[model samples]
Target: MSFKGEHHPGVQTPTAESAGFRFNHTMLRVKDPETSLAFYTRVFGMVVLRRLDFEEMQFSLYFLARLGEGDAVPDETGERTVWTFSQTGLLELTHNWSTEDQPDFAYHDGNAEPQGFGHICFSVPDLEAAEAWFDENGVEFVKRSDQGKMKDVAFVKDVDGYWIEVVQADRMA
Candidate 1:
């Protein structure tokens, strides 16, 4: 199917003033939840805000975020679901049940030949410090902050081989 949209140089799409919008979350399929969860929590200090299991569907969704200090997650599922929707900067990891038994299972990281998806990014307060911590923690590095042509950015791979771009907030223009 062919899709087409034309953009006039100075034209802007209109939306109702009452409409509210926000970029909610991006989901990535992971082979192993334990390893993937551990990597995000341990390396980035993200908390598992909510987890929804679909036994019949044979898949699970885990939502994680780096909440503000002293922020608490709601105990009740309904309240938690509301809280989850209200917050921003969420990372959702979807795990398929069958992948657990297949030790050799792997997912297309989107960076290969048929590249459709790129990489997810995280902004750090101190790029050097984060890079140091990553090195100390033995995390795999795809492109170190100093090695590539883009000297200000760094890329690292999670357990599932998904590339995450790490950038410094202050250094960004």
Candidate 2:
């Protein structure tokens, strides 16, 4: 079952009609907006690109991104919304009302029994420094970089117990 060559025989190349298609973002449901926001911003240095509140739906969609240098973020609401959707690798956190108040409430992290969604990954410039920073911030590690059989790779759990895989690209090379 080695997919060394073409994985899908039917589609040798991308469809011409889908040339403009781009991966927008990955959405994850959070129990508490405040806690989740803090974890993403502090740990990953992501900025809130846009936040849409659906009062009728009783949920809020927060779009966050790790903006690079000279990345322009429109201040206007409509423009910001457009910019947020145009970017790739964005993280969207959906917070439902009253879920934060429920002390026993928790989202299945997709790593347990009957697992579906696995985890999101973050490639860091410096693995050692990032691991130290995670330690300083009291991040819970599922597997340290040097702990398991896999070297130069780590997995840490967020406040919501979501596994975030950390890796250094250069190390893999």
Candidate 3:
């Protein structure tokens, strides 16, 4: 298959929109993988697929699957892109090389001002289960009620101060 005179295996002829293109996981760098991994797995209901190490590179990458993205298989061999699929979406935790010269990176803080990048939003089918997970993991939130669009929506933050919005969309009333 070819696209624009280039060999594109999946896409024979790419248009403005392609079926192969879809919204996948979001990436976040964490200073402490242990803490961040736990927070995401426990609070937001993520699962770790595997952990790879680059000893010479001096960093580790943790692959986590989002909510119902469990057991997703990817059929690609890429250097930077760890391929995975999810019922909802995918997640990739990239641990960069840390050395004497490597400067530290910063993750987002829950929208205290809403000026920078806004929080990443997700959808939870069972609102009660989502609420319970938050409470159990000690996630703090500022609650509000807005039902004009969907069901009730809530906000919460992870351990590293990254904001997350979980939408509770039930059937129409």
Per-candidate Cα lDDT values, in order, are: 0.91, 0.94, 0.64
User: TM-score for each prediction?
Assistant: 0.89, 0.93, 0.62
Stretches off by above 4 angstroms in model 2 are 1-11
Which scores greater on TM-score, model 2 or model 3?
2
Worst 10 residues of 1 by lDDT: 1-10
Which pairs of residues collide in candidate 1? none
TM-score quality measure for candidate 2: 0.93
Q: In model 2, how many backbone clashes occur? A: 0
lDDT assessment of candidate 2? 0.94
Give the winner by lDDT: 1 or 3: 1
RMSD of 2: 3.5
Model 1 TM-score on a 0 to 1 scale: 0.89
Worst 10 residues of 2 by lDDT: 2-11
Ranking by lDDT: 2, 1, 3
Q: In candidate 2, what are the lDDT values of residues 16-73, reduced to their tens digit?
A: 8988999999999999999999999999999999999999999999999999999999
lDDT digits (tens) for residues 1-173 of candidate 1: 55335678976665687367776789999998998999999999998888999999999999999888787889999999889988877999999998967978999999998998889999999999999999998889999889968998999999999999999978878
Of the candidates shown, which would achieve the greatest lDDT relative to the real structure? 2
| Deviation (Å) of 159 in candidate 1 | 0.2
